[model samples]
Target: MMLTCIAVDDEPLALRLIANFIEQTPFLQLVGSYSSAAAALRGLQQQTTAVDVLFLDIQMPDLNGLELARVLDKGPGTDKPRVVFTTAFNQYALEGYKVDALDYLLKPFDYAEFRRVADKALAYANATRPTAAEPALLPQEDYLYLKVEYQLVRVDFRDILYIEGLKDYVKVYRQSEARPLLSLSSLKSLEERLPARQFMRIHRSFIIALNQVKSVSRSTVQIGSATIPVSDRHREAFDQFLSRWK
Candidate 1:
């Protein structure tokens, strides 16, 4: 079966790029493309049937990717389409998975990576129709890959100091480097998949490795100059995570 897909991005060029990529994939049927999350919502509402996949962009003007994903989640029943988050920014992956996206795509992604994610989405979509239960989402082993400018780089969890989400992107602050590396995975996705015994979500935008955390303040937690915020939602959990270290 073909995977029904849609592209939702604020930038016209971004939308075009995804559209072109989708067209090249044999199993993906470009069911719809929208320049805004609002338009995608309208299309979802007007169309009685469900879509197989969504290539959702996170940084739209009014209705951002996260909001759109949340809206799509409340379907008529449990059976619904898969989501593939597409964004230039990397921090939203954690938030993206909370809505259960099939995969995350960074901007300027090559065709090979596109096919990899598209195939996973196809499998997830097809899995729904089988006799067995929905497959348990698995976590990655060894390391995670990130798209940086023109190259694909591997980042081991041990090297990270903290991660901060910006719009659709994530800034991975490292222990050895002065600069933070940007990646396509969201803070939410990282929070879920990353070994929680090692990492802590201290804020909505920040996730820090428990061993890497040097000190804590009323407003922030520090790892070098990378001061991660402590938000109300994460405060209690972070406190508990820290207590284990104490």
Candidate 2:
């Protein structure tokens, strides 16, 4: 059966590329391409059709993929499509898992691996919906443990947006109504501690949630209309991340 899919990414090129790839892949039928999570939700809400898989990019302007996944779970559909996250960073892997994502692809992943992951997701998307007795229907938890005030804290993985360097201190952005920017210790030092799957070093200064960003191109990441520069050193990985979207 053709697995119907809708890809949501921030880059126009990435969306076009996925569309092209869908055309060639017999198992996947391209349902739509959305430049932002908001756009995808609008179309999906129109109640026009059903999709089997989601090729989702994490970071976006209005609604990021993780949040979008949570939204989809509440939709009228009895069962939701399998979600596969496409991102450049590795730090958010645990969080993606928390969102019940089928798989997480690091930026610049090999095309062969992508196909492999896609195949698995297709099978899951087509599997029988969880029955009331099945625990798979429960919301999965993704969190990072932290020691604060003589106690351990279980922070929901998706609460973070960015963690900034502050000499010796680290500030974590948590579940605030608005996206939070945090202060943190040395960027390099913190990078070592982050989960390799969910976080990536896009620049010497910034550690973005692999699933939080909206989109990217050769030059910049779209933060609003402003373009955030992609460091020359990170170009290769960034290009690879962008290629899958293509």
Candidate 3:
């Protein structure tokens, strides 16, 4: 798939360089290029088509790239663009990952380095791309496979007590196991794959099995020994689900 992209840099040369690189890349299509993060934000808001990727420079005078990434990360829209931080400084690398940036391109980077991160961004975009086809609910399918340590581990849905999201990874708590299954994946992706009738996202960082919830105490849910918080965003839906149970 051809991924649409935008570049945001305070420097005219840097912005032009990224734009040129994007044009040279076969899979990437440069939709917009801006001299500031604010202008890029406005362009993103006003654009007709959803931007799939963002090539952002970390340092800027107004609305720095990191702050812009955070704003887009919490956006109400589900089709949030993937971020690739471009900066001369290496210190912002850790912070960029916190916002779930797909890659980081250091300043003075060669075309080869740019292409490598671009390829990674394209793969990520395609993997998380939404499809018109609805997922089938296979009731008899009790287990799901997760790639862990380069191996696919089978995890039974009935054994799952709750899921705790840790940035790009998730810890799946099980009934019988002492240690939770850790895997490299986003909570949103897993939530979409699981059967919605049996599982519900109670918080931005938690998803619990309806059958495993022992009790609900105000804004918290009790499942086994763990207490998961139900944020205000998800509380109303949880309350409605409880009402249906009654």
Q: In candidate 3, how many clashes are counted?
A: 0
Candidate 3 lowest-lDDT run of ten: 131-140
The Cα error of candidate 3 at residue 114, in Å, is 1.1
Ranking of candidates on TM-score, top first: 3, 1, 2
Greater lDDT among 2 and 3 belongs to 3
- Tens-digit lDDT track for model 1 on 16-99? 988998999999888898998999989877766777788988888999988988887865765566778888788886787667
TM-score of each: 0.53, 0.50, 0.65
User: Residues 15-89, candidate 2, lDDT per residue (tens digit)?
Assistant: 776676667677888887899999988877763667777889998888998899988865664547778788877
RMSD of each: 9.2, 19.9, 6.6
How far in Å is the alpha carbon of 198 misplaced in model 2?
40
C-alpha lDDT values of all predictions: 0.77, 0.67, 0.85
Where is model 1 more than 4 Å wrong at Cα? 131-246
Question: What lDDT does model 1 reach?
Answer: 0.77
Residue 234's C-alpha lDDT in candidate 1? Answer: 80
